[model samples]
Target: MVSYAAENQLVHLLYARGYAVMRAPRSGRVGLPTPDLVAIRGKKVLVIECKSRKTGFTVEREQLEQLKEWKRRTGGAAYIAWKRTRLGLFLKLADVIKNKGNVGKKFAEEYGIKIKNEE
Candidate 1:
């Protein structure tokens, strides 16, 4: 499970930038998975799944597929925020994870998204 504090910190960063953000509820009894954060600014919508790199970037297949489906259906960009890094990494999930165990650095680097936070 992703840490609430990490997700909260990421959401706070977006909120500081005047972006509207909401935390998606966990999928337990609901049986439906949702992105970790839903951020909106103007016409930009970010379906972000927040994770802490301290434990490595990990995402569920169902969540990833749902995010992709959301993009296809809603036209919003989906990203996996790899938190707790040197400057944090916002990886735009290109597609569903193939025959892999985890979403590794090489795969994330392919997105070419390097968001530097103002320290």
Candidate 2:
């Protein structure tokens, strides 16, 4: 099994920001297309796929498609949270899918969304 430390960190962050979050159980093994985390705060919704790596990371096209479908169905925002170090980078799914799922370190650092409260 893969470590979910990155996802847990993200959950805590979202929780601190007042979002009610749920982590999909057995995410990749569930046989259904689902993101790693779903967070909702009032009218806003966020579906996130989390990844942790020492360098860059790649998301499969199928996974990207799944996220797109989820966004379409839920009318929520989709994101990819890539954790390369202690603090992670958050990239909009729309932007990442345009690159065909390759999130290089440079691109991540340049384009990743920076939350105001992130330490």
Candidate 3:
């Protein structure tokens, strides 16, 4: 399981950027597929799965597949935060995460989540 600290940091970054962020409910009763983090900005909704690097930058294939299915079903953006490195990475990822449509497309095609784009 990812640490609470990493999850908290991710939430903090999202919240600071005017996003309404929340942790995924663990009860599994919501029927709304619980993502690791949910951030909404205006009409855009982003669902993120966070992975801590306490072990390495690795994620289970099953989890990734599940997240992808959730994104497709919810019509929301889905992302994976590989490591809790710095606030900058969090901020960068948050930006991409907030763009649900584009991010969702990229995630579905690539099976990889990307951050930091050239400006």
Task: Say which candidate scores most in lDDT.
Answer: 2
Summed backbone clashes in each candidate are: 0, 0, 0
Clashing pairs in 3: none
Q: Who wins the TM-score comparison?
A: 2
Task: Report the C-alpha lDDT of model 3 over 1-119, residue by residue, as the tens digit.
Answer: 66678778768877877899988746544765467888989978787877664333434555556677777876777776645354223322334444432333334234443343232
Q: In model 1, where is the ten-residue run with the lowest total lDDT?
A: 95-104
Cα lDDT tens digits, model 2, 32-112, are 888889999998999988887877778899989999999999999999988776657789998898888998977887889
RMSD of each: 2.9, 2.1, 7.9
TM-score of each: 0.77, 0.89, 0.61
The TM-score, computed over Cα atoms with residue i paired to residue i, of candidate 3 is 0.61
* Model 1 steric clash pairs: none
**Would you list the rank order by lDDT, best first?**
2, 1, 3
lDDT score of residue 29 within candidate 3: 43
